[model samples]
Target: MTAEIFATTPEGDTVEIVTLQNGPATARVMTWGATLQDFRLDGTPHSLVLGSPVFEPYRSRMRNYGAVVGRAANRIAGGRAPLNGATVQLETNEAGRTAIHGGSDGCGYVNWSLASHSETSATFTITLADGQAGYPGNLALTATYSLDDEGALTLEITGTTDAPTFCNIAHHSYWNLDGTPTLGGHTMHIDADSYLAVDEHKIPQGGPQPVAGTRFDFRQPRAITTPQDDPKLDHNFCLRLPGTEMHPACTLRAGDLQLEIDTTEPGLQVYDGSGLNSEVPGHGGVPYGPHGGVAIEPQKWPDAPNHPDYPQITLNPGETYRQVSRFHVTRI
Candidate 1:
């Protein structure tokens, strides 16, 4: 592991970026948002993940580009959910109707303290005050990134709350295997046979729906072209029967580069970069726009706290919340 001062925030806080290399993969992680700034492989000098050229873009235009999002990674309908037989209204951050990514208090918006680091691993820790973002709990969160000899990058998220609260964290990395202008040619395969149906606001509507007759199906490898109705995908696919362990979720390929994603979570949200039209300069002086990358986030189902039928995402006192996601890259 190698650490350097990446940038000094406007608040006078110095942010550090740690580089971890193992085998054919190298990853750069930043303290701010515990973000994955860059990822590359041996054969390709080009970065496999989309990132801004400078640090300021991350605080403004590209806030979610490569951050660790939480305390609930997805949306909660009406910005509210029932906890312990009572409704808990959260602080709305998405158009004042839903709590998306834990609002301003999400882990992605804050800096984390580097707990430890080694040649192939690094761990970060952060504390969320009780009632912060209108959630009940003084949460202690930790995220660890590790790279194995086989070019597998694993992100393990763990949290414990003093009170009962939601804890569903996700690492949001926009991958562009070819580092091209778009991800239209990337082929994707997900192990899920069902997906959650969302409303116009991208909040969960009904329970899990079969992907057999829907465009959400990705059981077989297929090109990830954007649909005409919706700009791109942002729905959660159910991968487990609830009460299962870690398993393979999806695989993505672009040209000679491929990534296999496996996670312990039950849901995987695939977001094609249709909304990333920022003119900010990306790495290698590339101008990022729509379809520049794709984000595959693993977490508990969106709005699971409200829907009793869905997998639960509650973390009580003394109980730890844990989720692990691994990305195995290969040159094909």
Candidate 2:
């Protein structure tokens, strides 16, 4: 593991950037938000993801660019949910009425502690106090990023709570295979028969709806900006359940670069960078605009607390939470 001082927090805390290398792939991870600062392959001239060159933009501008999001990965309606047969009010950070991504006090903004590091892997840990984000229990979470010689990067997140709480951790990385100005030409294919429908505020309507005959269908590879593509997409695509084994969830291709996203989670949220308009220049001094990249977040179904039919997101006192996801890039 190679480390360097990345930046210092406003509170006078030190933050570092750790780099893990394996064969042709190199990943630079920052302690702030446990975020992926840069990912590059040996022969590639451009970085694989959209990210700022400094820490300030990550905190002030970039929506969740390559951060470890949690407590709850998605929204909870009315800023409240049921816990132990009672209502638990949550901190509202989205439009002042809903709790999105653990209410802005989420793990994405916290500086995680470096748990351990080696040549090819690094682990970062964060502790979420009970009721810190309006959730119960004290949650101890660890996010580990590992890269193999075969050019596959795996992110494994594990958590354990001291009391009953809601925990759904997901990696939020905006990927741009070629690091181009726009991802409109990128081809994408998601392995999902149905996707959760969302309302105007991007909240899940009720349950999963069939993707057939709809723009959500990605059973086959298609250009991301085709007529079938929606102007803005923040919906969660429902995958096969049980989630005991990792499987190929989606594939994104841009020219000669291809990225295969696989995960053990049953849901994948696809964001096409529609709302990205950043003043801070990304790596290589490129200003990221709308559709600058695409985010493929793998985790539990959104708003699971209110919908009993969806998969559960609860973590009991003695239970452990685990999610495994991989991003494998190759030249086509």
Candidate 3:
């Protein structure tokens, strides 16, 4: 276990990138909510690959950059919806369409303090101010980053909402296993048999539709950019039913590197990073150019507050919310 000063860009930020090396895997974690900076397998080393000719200043565009995203990880469908019969309104930040993740008041910006850190795992915990996002309940969120002796990256989130509010936490890390901009070569396979149909606003419009007849099916495993897929990959997949505990959700691979992402959440949002700010300055202490990484976010469905049939993302009192996502790295 080793630590390096990543950057101090967020202004008065204590961004610590903790590196954990176990055999063939090396992972970098930021104290800012335990964000995953980079996860490398067999020492391929693209977690923070920059300073190249075609790829200069691409790290800045990282949305989560390697951090935990939550309160609600996806859209709230206009950012204003009712939860548990209570009219909970949120700021609309996602193209005037939905309340993505949790909104501007969402946890995306909050700097969760590091609760603990050690050789194999690091834990980050933060408290959400009351009336912070129009929700009445105070919240305490925790994310634990751990790398097992077997070379797998584990991210576990535990949070409690005092009031009735949605609480689906997710880690947003853009992955570039090949260490290249163009992710057209990466392949993705999700276990579910169907995906929810969405409207133009990127909001769910229909129930789980079979992947059997659409390009959404990945049961056989194929490249994400394989001609059959749509140009922009930004839709909330009605992932495999999260039965009772943590389970396998999808397998993502780019060239020689592969990541097995598992979560306890019922759905996963696989963003293609089509609009990722290649121009956004990243925490690698430099500017990131276009397509630096691909974000495979595992969480409950977006706007679950409105969809009664959908799995609940809201956390109420007397109930403890727990979602664990594992990024098991393998060299192929």
Give lDDT: candidate 1, residue 138.
Answer: 91
Given candidate 2, what's the lDDT at residue 303? 84
C-alpha lDDT of candidate 3 relative to the true structure: 0.69
**After best superposition, candidate 2 residue 279: deviation in angstroms?**
1.1
Better of 2 and 3 by lDDT: 2
Model 2 residue 67 lDDT score: 94
TM-score of each: 0.96, 0.97, 0.88
Instruction: Determine which window of 10 residues in candidate 1 has minimal summed lDDT.
Output: 223-232
Q: Write candidate 2's Cα lDDT for 92-172 as tens digits.
A: 888898888886779998889988888899999999999887898899999999999887899999999999999998899
TM-score of 2: 0.97
List, residue by residue over 187-266, the lDDT tens digit for candidate 3: 88887887777877888885778879677777877877654556467766767665657778888777777778878777
Q: Residue 17, candidate 3: how far off, in angstroms?
A: 2.9
Overall lDDT per candidate, in order of appearance: 0.88, 0.88, 0.69
Could you tally the backbone clashes for each prediction?
1, 0, 20
Q: lDDT tens digits, residues 189-248, model 1?
A: 999989988888998888889989677888999877756634358899999544557798
